[model samples]
Target: MSSSPAALSGGTVANPRSRVILASLIGTTIEFYDFYVYATAAVLVFPHLFFPPGNDATALLASFAVFGAAMVARPLGAIFFGHLGDKRGRKVTLVGALLTMGIATFLIGALPTYHQVGWLAPALLMLMRLAQGFALGGEWSGAALVATENAPAGKRAVYGTFPQLGAPLGFILANGLFLIIAAILPSDDPSRPSQAFLDWGWRIPFLFSIVMVAVGLWVRLNLVESTAFEKTVKAGKVHSLPLVSVFRTHTRQLVLGTFYMLATYVLFYLMTTFSLSYGRAAVNGALPGLGYDYTTFVLMMIIGVVFFGIFTMLSGPWADRWGRRGTLIGVTLAIIAFGLLWVPMLAGGTIGVMAWLILGFSLMGMTFGPMGALLPELFPANVRYTGSGISYNVSSILGAAVAPFIAIALWSWGGGSPFWVGLYLSAMAGLTLIALLMGTETRDVDIEA
Candidate 1:
């Protein structure tokens, strides 16, 4: 006699692998949106609202320092969450991280300004920002590993790119929201307008994430466990201590993977922070050069994000065909070459600004697109989450946390020559290139048990 339909369906559960990818993509996008919303606010609003003291330059620097503090906390988060994820399950760890980020972001939005609470306001903001950074440390690695591991044998790169796309996509929305808010306010009274922004306008973005978190939770709930991980567990190959396992067995992959991300990480900071500062400096000057205002500069970034998405979409198929190592190596060289154009175009003004943003973001997309697949693929299935998370986050210490400060110091100390900055970017790319060359290609690594 034929088995019942329910019995047959239960015999082989539907993959629901697509659900896993969708969940990772949506959840990551929301988490990053929350994190970067604060980043954009740190540059635009926090200096005046929270640190309204001393000279404008000093206040701005102080605000950036607080922003850097968040980055400093990220490695800690990586270690903490990385341990939890490796020991517990990926879903629960990610859920806790998301909740922390969402709540912190919401609290930031609702924070009392310095005017209302004296020193207490900024202190609270700093604390919340620290939480934000810590949460992000775990979020990226978990989502990337989930998406890639659930993907079909040959399509890991393509599936993995969806999670990476969240960064630029979130950036677009975060900055885009702020841009709209900034546009609506009347510019007739400059100080009053900015004061009004500090009081309430800046908080709107942070508050929006509360809604985002609810949505992310709903989507995440439906996700099934990763098939690769499931296989490892069933085979009794799951590591008791994933972090220790990675350090002991996959030391080379850990070191190389982190170093390999150096260029892209620094490039990410420059695109967001330094570029905004440069645009502001130009607009305040009385020159007919490419002195576009913040709105214009951000709009240019929006255009570039489109290309970022395209290049990311292209990476999946390209990596699957050319191999991940080749794609990563070629892109690193391209970034190095792009650095050569910095002095010429940045000195040229508006057109130059557009050129630089376009070129930099294009290279960013290519390199970042393949990394999600490449990094995890480097590790054996037993410790994939812990190995990839540690390498990815520890790399942040060298590559991202100090990149903007280093860039600014270079500009200040070089007597106005951005050549130092260009060299800095090039040096990072060169480091990553060496790491990639020395690493293994995991395109054909076994995924199924």
Candidate 2:
């Protein structure tokens, strides 16, 4: 008795394993590269270039406000793109999201600064930032589905990691480029970017998106739709309104999936955005920091993110073996521990900070990796795109969108101690742990069913 429903649906050639992996991986790499490029600049360049000259804290806060605003646009984009992905197909949706992000990023590169265009500078920047967020809202879930839907029996989690791998790769590439540019345009002072870097060098990464997006579009356009979605189409299971269908049928999973991803998002922004701010802020300022120069701190982040990539790849097999829920449970516990311990680590000076970074990023990877399969597994094929995108992006609003802003507030509250920030991370991880405890093991779930 043949039990391969995908095969029984019709005689269709399976998506080439390499193609599925590469398409999903490359698309997200480009998406995240665009995002992190903006993120790095929000910290390094935007405060000076976009906002009018003023109090440093107010300027930095304004920059972060624009940065967080993008997270608000994410769920909206998810709704639009999810509708398209579920109704049309993942391949076209992926290409559309990539184009959206690429164009926004490239345009941001060309935009005039506050000095050049006054209020229009920040307005244009916020508009492009929203577009980037919207594009990403649809990008991740589609890519995750591509990997998991194309996966062979018992290997969905492993295949799912392909998209997750993009986060670290994109972070490295984005920050690495900034570091190189900072080096090329050396500053008169050791602690800050050179005047040239401030003026024009930062735009290079944003402008470079055009080239990367071209490559992503090429790979994604070549992809055949995943068999699971193909089967959904043939069976006429595609919902006219996938968002309505998901909310009506999969409401419980939607809630669980959102909280389940909470800690991961919190840790991610804390480790990247908040850390860079904390690490480089002057030691004697109103909000005291470690006083490391900007270049040194970014270099440290690149080192930690290397571990993030390694563990992200490792999480696939681990989740495949132990199941997504179980693997995440363990990782979540570790995140809680790391959150509590990071205070001392930050105080331990450079080596301690590095240890804190490695530990934090490792936990980030382990927690972040499994969700590529875990979230999609929460719903059946017909609603997978919509359900996953909604859960993922809504959680972005709750977690990622507010994390940096909240962390900054907490940091200031504690007199730049970072104690409150670490505690805040622990608390979010606690919520995620509870959600994991409530979730079912999805490793063996028939996603196509």
Scored by CA lDDT, what does every candidate get?
0.78, 0.92
**TM-score of every candidate relative to the true structure:** 0.92, 0.97
**lDDT tens readout by residue for model 2, 50-118:** 998977889899999999999999999999999999999998999999999999999999999999989
Model 2, runs deviating above 4 Å: 1-9
Name the candidate that leads on TM-score.
2
Summing lDDT over every window of 10 consecutive residues in candidate 1, give the lowest-scoring window: 1-10
Total clashing pairs for each candidate: 1, 0
* RMSD each, Å: 3.6, 2.8
Error at 165, model 2, angstroms: 0.8
Any runs in candidate 1 off by more than 4 Å, and if so which? Answer: 1-17, 188-193, 283-290, 415-417
Q: What lDDT would candidate 1 get against the real structure?
A: 0.78
Model 2: lowest-lDDT 10 consecutive positions: 1-10
What are the per-residue Cα lDDT tens digits for candidate 1 across 1-449? 21111221335332355566676788778877886787777667887788776566566667777777777777778777777776666778788888988999999988888878989988998899899889888888888877887776689899889898888888888988988888875345432235567668888999999998998887776555655666677778877777778788889888998998899888888777766655555433321124456677789988877788789889889999999999999999998888777889787766776788888888888999998898888887777777787778777778777876787677667655667888899989999999988987889987553
